[model samples]
Target chain A: MGKRPDRRESFVVRLYVADREATAVRAIANLEALCREFLPSGCELEIIDILREPQRGLDDSIMVTPTLIKLAPPPVRRIFGDLSNRGRLLDALGLTGLELSPPRP
Target chain B: MARKNQKEREPRLAKAQTGIDGVDEITGGGLPRGRTTLLAGPAGSGKTVLALQTLVNGARRFDEPGIFVAFEEGFQQVAANAASFGWEIPSLVQKRGRRSPRLAFVDGRLSPGAVQAGTFDLSGLLAAVEFRAKEIGAKRIVFDGIDVLLVMLNDPRVERGEMCRIHDLLERAGVAGVVTMSTAGLEPPGSFMLSLSDCIIQLTHRLAERASIRGFRVVKYRGSAFIANEFPFAIASQGIEVADFGTRPKYRVFTERVSSGIPRLDHMLAGGYFRGSTVLVTGMPGTAKTTLAGAFVAAACARGERALYISLDEQPAEILRNLASVSIRLERYVRSRLLEIYADHPQETSPEEQFVRMRQRIRAHRPSTLVIDPISAAIRMGGQSTVLGVAERLLAMAKSEGITTLWTSLYQGSEEAMEATPLHVSTVADTWIHLSYRAGRGERNRSLTVIKSRGTGHSHQVRELILDDRGVDLADVYTVGGEALMGTARWEGERAEVATQRDVEAEEARKRRELEILAAEIRAQTEGLERRRESLAAEMRLLDQSITLRERNESRRQQEVRARRGGEPASRAGRRKGRSAPTED
Candidate 1:
């Protein structure tokens, strides 16, 4: 196996969304906010527009738009539905114990 | 008002031929073009295969490019599964030409990370389909197991909305598409896809009569006509073939005749069965039904025409042996490839499967004649309606191909059953020959009766069937006092007639001998009288001689003695008188 890359560099995240759609826009903004706030060490993020690159979406087995996938850092995690609930999104991403904002009441 | 009239005008929907053998026949021309058709069925009901085959056949046959989007199975799996039927999917998809049809497959099967952190619609699926269709200029599309993807969305509202969106997208793209949905408990009671699609075809599989039968029906078709009855379909080695009664082939009347292999039977049928006609030979057990069918097969093969015999009750070897006893030699024809006998147990497969296999064999063999030995066994495999459907399709196929067919039906001896006709096969059959046992005259005799023969004159008399080493033989019906006599009874009648004729001749000969004896007696009596008269005449002659001598003496005496003459003359006179009397006598 190849040498383990840097922690933040190894983590590759991709978010699939339809181009210019309302939920897709919100999902991208929310994902960006989550990455910036949680993964302060920086994480590789790629946004795929299903409308523009449908083949990529099909290849990735994306049934719905605005689907998030953590490709690297082992034990890949997935979250669905625009990532609106920050706590649930973090929990689904396996980042619950990581340094981040406290849960809202 | 003119603009409103133009808006209100109904646009005629274009039809897209599915290119499947019987599907397009059931769906009018095909599903309404540039619209969505919902194909819902349980797993293993061939929903995926049906959709994929439409695309495959469209690409191969009609020069219509198509896109196949699979949500459950992978593209490779689909291609490999189709490869068994000799449908090369991967190559077909890869092949491209300037104007030739093309095939594109989009695998929409979800992985573990497929759905994550996103509020998504069916845009991804729609985009993939549209992009591929556009890339290949496809005019047909298929979404296989799309309901699985919808179910994964975990919201009925999203599923309904997604179904509507997909319908609109397919219609706007102007590509005729078929969408397959899985209905194994994941489907809600009231289906969203069924309501949104322009046409909905439901496929169902059930176990009946100890076998699994698959069926499909067009639940709804908007702005078009379709077959509503649930038609039986089979997933054969090639693909799904539905037995659709709506598109039943109309066959022209064939005037030619085919022999039934029995000369007397041919005579009974007025020169055999009409070409392309269905002949039902019904009888009780031990009536040689199969043997009669064997004769038909033998005749077909003898005429240098191919024959197919489906032996459901007996194995091919057993049938050959049994037929051989009756001098119907099918072994040589089988060896010569002029005849093919397919032997299968009725309980081994469903009636639908048997029908499909039979059709496949027919297509492969293209026989001029087909025979089903004891079709009663096949009828027993399913409900009356199901079996009738199978039988009807078989008969239709045979008729359409102008193949003479003979089906043997076993009928128990009952007035109602025999009169009513078992399974209504009598109606479908062009000619029906009923055979039964005559248990009279202290022996069992087989009788063959032509119950009904259409389009030609047939003998109504029941012929006594005599089966020997020379095959089936029909004897002239013998009736005494309006009662048909057979076996010992007929022989007894003939014997009695012969005896009566002999008795009359003997009595006449005795009377003639008595008359000859009486004539001999009368002649003997007459001969005796004649003999007496002759004797008397002889005596008289002798007497006359004597009298003449006496008279002479008397005269001499008279001369001699004059004095004594008186006494002598008197004696002489007496003597003369006596002599004269003798002479006159």
Candidate 2:
């Protein structure tokens, strides 16, 4: 009713991990689930292994591992942690305003 | 030695490829031909890998057959590792058949007696290499894990002597060779080998918080000029690679300007940087070097040009958020595949590996612009000459690929106090932008100046800069009070003092004027009061005279009545006689 057009949008979320070891692997798994649950239908996700592709990490200005970068809606957002915390991850992705259904009884 | 006839022309010297992707540019093509190059490093520093990659690259890419001698790992292990990196070494060996280069794997437990008492079995190693080289017409050779040979000998003197012998033999064979030595804790015992060899490259592995960094320096390269600094490198699945990091002019056919994403900064650079040019930015710590690099990447991305940012110091998340404060949003670009960010420390890997990784990434991304923020960290990780060699190679690669490369150098201490930049980056840079902080008139100020730009016209004067929520802005060049304050500290102090002094002087002058006006008003009022008093005195005197005249007339009238009534006739007659005389007078 606000007269604003409901335009479909798409974006990419990049994750940079220090080493492709267990910690990075687990973080990636959690991030994938969080993205599926919280992100819109058109959104995409990517993970960059800094150790394997160190040059890509440098080019992206990624120094630390397990860093999540949100690229959408013009202004970009980034979170530096595992994406297991649902509330914090959503806030970091700038998806705080999206509504979710209540838990089933 | 063969003597040339005076009239006859001298033959051109054959060049040796450094095996680094773009290193040919710095050394005028490559290392000196038919000379030994000592490559030294600590344990797990990828020295062997670097030497192997150079040999393999020469063999496969340049069609130059090479010989590799391994003192530690077996031939199969080395081949397996190479395979994981997408290289088919076994096939290459099979293709050459009997002419292929030989891989000599020596068991570490081999006794000293087998080495011939005090003499190392140089003849045996030489025979194997010579046999392979003759079969394959090989021109290059590499010694993998020389430290094992030295350790097995158990005598520094013996090691030095054997290295000298090997150096002489390699020179005599007319074969270009690279010897990899383990530096671990011992001071490079290969100094003897390095001194005898035509070139010496020192590799270092540094561990920094959660990241591994590798660096390399060229100690000496005879018969050719090389960049002189430690350069960042890495080890990947394929092999060792080096980041061609240096301060060199980037040459391109195009003469177009590229935006920096920030409007005000674009004006400061005389309308942004030229396309495919190298820009060197030198500044102190926390002067926004990373932020500026990020902004440039963002601008390139907005224009649909692929941009790559290489960070050698910080983590990706930290850098991204820091840039976000300046309104440089990298997340969007990353998602769009328009911007690529690579972050690593200098200690986790080797310079050769880092270089290979960079080359692969660049080839895949094909970015229009590339940025390395604070190249000093990478340089610090290696020796001066080695870093320079890497820089030289990087410059060539960027120029050939037509990618605009921007590098930031951290200049420690005060800008004015520093006699020279940390690295001699100005020598290789096409456009050198120097940033400094100065304290003037009790205020700190920041200024930026362009030292030089190869082909483009730029502002020579230093301009003041401001960083805020809206991004960086260049203020007018300060010219107040004959002293130019360089940062916010000095500028603010000068302004506040000038304002306070002016305000105090203005207040005192105002007070003096008010006092003078009050005095004049008081004098005017006193004069009016005196005139009114005088006028009142004169009126009183006139009234007194009128009253006195009336009284005298009334007395004369009364005296006449008394004389007519005859009551005071005698007194009036006597008084009339005296009064008549006075009246006549």
Candidate 3:
């Protein structure tokens, strides 16, 4: 169930990959940067490498590698391939007009 | 994790036993163990089924756990499909009570809209297989339609690399693997992947003259000898059964005799047909072939032995009705389970498929006798080679099981060759009865001829085939002027012989009566002659007596004359002469 977080403005995203393949590494890094820039202190990210945990990928019906799904802020959206398209990811996450928050230690 | 180095412990020469009907024999045992075996075939050729069945059979028979990775179908769909063959996939895959699961299925089907462009691999599928194999301690794994997953990559390099990785993964896991690949047309799957596998099997389906034939070949087997021919197979209700045409079955020669349902016919066949021998009843159309077969089956059932009658032209009810016309009631036997009638249209399936079904039926019913009425219809399903192949196998199967089999074949041509039968089964059959029609005497008459009866004396003369409500009866060969007679001609010939015999007998009786009358007339004439003689004798005696009296009187006169004057003697002599003359008259 992709439900909205309770009592707080939260960001939840899941990134699927196959071990440390280049596209998977790039997708993880790009997704982390986007979460750090957009959701600041309240962002939660769960990265799943199919190689390590294929059952979870099967449960999520993940067919492609380096797939990202935004599971919060009301509606859920998915992006396939490398997560290098920052604008499309932002638009998919419904953060079109959101400002970048300062990085937290 | 106490995981051992499975690669180091693998047996290089060991093979995984495929519990299919004939696959193990074809592969000289089974596929190379703990290695990848590629199963390639066209769609609907039973590639997925063969792979899945191998896994199921392995788990069930060999006590080996298995994992199934479906790349084209979901786990639920696969389970549902397997259910048709009576394989309880759910129970095999899930744990209930304290019993551990022997099988696991992973659905790897891709969604319609799901697409990837960046780096990707089948590592996820590998991980799923490995995890499940570890959980259940599986020794066998099946990848149903791995080509589907391979096609998804769209990159040849990655696909190749992933294929190698999967091979390596299976090798390291020390589990036997069957990777099924679906192909189109005749060209096989990727040669690289094929070369990398330990063994390769190819399955194909082709339709020939209204028959759909499924065949498989063991293309290559590493470190083992195998049968490399393309063997036809069928997907029966009990899964797949491969037909090995090359195997020469061993048969026991049974000495017991069985009645042919016709006492006279059995007399023609010595005592009766040999118990484990094959009887072929060949004839033209409307020659009572089915009726003859029915008679044999009925007789078998009467003997209290199970009988199976497979009719390709008529349904079971129709066969029963037709059999009843000949006073052969099979319903009682059927109801009592001593007789089983399996009737289906010859056009319903290929000859091979029909044979497979028959094999299954035989296994289930364990019939002591089998009758295939009009086997020509079944032989017509395929070409000459196929027909011959099926015939050989069928006869061998029946003989090996000591089943007395009867088959009727129809010859449609005008010329009659008693020695040559359809499907060329005459060579292997123990007895052959040929029925034909003679277009003479203004009516077509059926004649039965025993072409060949091995190890027994048979009647050489063609007898008249009479089929009636009383059952099949072969009339004694009625011949006239060196030609065997039939129908009205036969009846006429028989009548003429009887009439001739009656004429000879009547003529002899009349001659005897005339001789008796002639002897009586001769006797009467003899008696009349004797009576005449007696009367004549009486007359003669009377005359003599008269003469004697005259003489005496004459003498007395003479004496009186002498006294008077000697003149009476002359008068006496004259009286004597007169008496004599009267007596003579």
Candidate 4:
């Protein structure tokens, strides 16, 4: 949780994971797609593998893998799990509205 | 024989001592090492305090670094809450010199009001704890209030998975772990949570008789023997302490007698109280309980021994002043450092704190004699019934240290209730002296009876206590006509007895004087009669002499007449003699 931002601050998000595992890959892809769709101004995404940089996980107070942390807002927030819950995930990231296209079968 | 030998050679499960006072003893040596212990209890049941205290003890006493993952409380809040306990936790969390922090707190609380997303694993929590454990080289960790975090997860399946992850991570790190869960009633968490751990400790704090009573139970301990009964516990100033934790120490026995300060009371006890034995003095209020205790302290101090008087309800100044009125002066002993009086208000603090404070003083002073005046007044205040636990510990400690102690307790109701001492500490006392108020003749009189004195003969008589400016003394109280003669009745009885004895002596004197007068009168009468008889005998002797003279004269005359005128003279003499002859005839 680095800088406090103004009202127009871009969402600088970081995802903590243990290497590029399947769950981590899924969370990364889902978060990037959601950010590109909603954050037209700008969005910065940082990936951290806890296996290599575990201290970062402690500094961020991460309790689960594939954790998404929106750190650049005035008040930083954390979302847990593998990003499978798109509706609640969007709600947690302050990107609620605008129903996306139907999921591919 | 070979199988037995192999069994003996096999290694036993290693244990990591939590260093909590009673926890280690109950678990046979704390939780299993490199394994998890499931701690379940209701809210406000001291679960969090127990967990945090374990971590603190591990860090301070065992030199084991510990991590506390606070789920319900933040780092600063936890530290602030624990500061009142006099533990140096805040300083321990900071780096000192070249050594790593002995204890560290990690906030595992999820963002407030953040509804649970679809599904989530505890990789983030696990990773954070593991990272901190490695950084501090922690050998012990406690996820305090884990139920708060789990309830938010909202799914039993996910909760089970997360608990397993925590267990596995701690096992891999070779760290002793404690996961605390909130329970309702007697029901613990899901079976999976219970089955996954090597130990289970259940704690409960509930109200009994409008007072809180905390309980501790070790449900199961794998690969170890443990005491299975539930024990009363308390969240004292130091931490949680279980009642009846250690082997109840055998009371110290001694043959030497020490005075009870009252010489007659000593005589009633044969040779005073046995040294190193606890003595209980029970009485109603205004029965001079403190005076008896003061007398004991004064006696001990006079013998050049140290004494500690713990007055749970009275101040030292007031105690000294009151004792002075009874002529048992203790100020000199206090000034000489031979006696120390600890004044405390049991109402102001829990019995656990009271016990700890007393024990600390006893250890510091090492007094050979101790007096807890009217322990009943404060032993069971309007709070937890932990006083019995405290009483046991205090008494056991006193016995082990060979301290001769005297405790006074207040008794109400009738004679039947006299045997029931508050906290039942009388059972452990070697001697009990009960003081009662015998009301009669419109007056109340204080009397003392020796209820029991083990290993020594004691008087069964109830002696009336006389309190005045001359100090305390026991007066013999006698029963007359089925009533104990006391006060004015005793004085009247004594006076009446003296008067009866005086009257009996007066009557005896009168009878003795009359007999002496009768003997004198009989002696005078016999003397008068003897004198008269002597006089009559003298008169008869004189008459005989005269008659003999006359007869000689008459015979001479007759002889002359007969010579001169023979016949004529003889006739004349015959005539004179005739009358005499007639008379003779």
Identify the leading candidate in terms of TM-score: 1
Clash number for model 1? 9
Note the DockQ of each predicted structure.
0.32, 0.00, 0.16, 0.27
Of 2 and 3, the candidate ranking higher by lDDT: 3
In the range B1-585, model 1's lDDT, one tens digit per residue, is 987665554246677887776888888888777888888888888898888778877888888889888888887788889998788887887755665438888777666543344456767667877877887888888888876776677788877777788888789889887888878633573377777788889999988766788888888988777889888888877888886546758887888889999998898787999999999988889998888898889888999999999888888999999999999888899999999999867776788878888888898999989998877887667776777778888999999999899998888867455767547478899998888888876789999989899987998888888899977888865667887778878767666666567777988998888888889999999999999999999999999999999999888766645644455577786676576656444
Estimated TM-score for each candidate: 0.79, 0.46, 0.77, 0.78
Rank by TM-score (best first): 1, 4, 3, 2
- Candidate 3: tens digits of C-alpha lDDT, residues B146-208: 788777776778778888987998898888888988877435336668988989999999988
Clashes (backbone N, CA, C under 3 Å), per candidate, total 9, 74, 0, 8
Could you give the fnat of all candidates in order?
0.67, 0.00, 0.30, 0.47
lDDT tens per residue, model 4, B277-391: 8898888888888888988888899999999999888899999999999999999999999899998888766665577678778988899999987678565564424666677
- Using DockQ as the measure, which candidate wins? 1
lDDT of each: 0.80, 0.67, 0.80, 0.79
Residue pairs with backbone atoms closer than 3 Å in model 1 (clashes)? A79-B116, A79-B117, A80-B116, A80-B117, A80-B118, A81-B118, A81-B119, A82-B118, A82-B119
Could you tell me the lDDT of residue B345 within candidate 3? 72
Q: A1-105 in candidate 3: lDDT tens per residue?
A: 122323266778788888888888888887777665655566778988887787787677665677777777667776776766665566667776563432222
DockQ of 4: 0.27
Q: Where is model 2 more than 4 Å wrong at Cα?
A: A1-105, B1-55, B62-73, B77-250, B282-286, B347-364, B379-402, B410-412, B424-472, B475-479, B482-585
| Residue-level error in angstroms, candidate 1, position B279 | 1.4
Deviating ranges (above 4 Å) for candidate 1: A1-10, B1-12, B76-86, B95-101, B113-115, B184-191, B481-483, B492-585
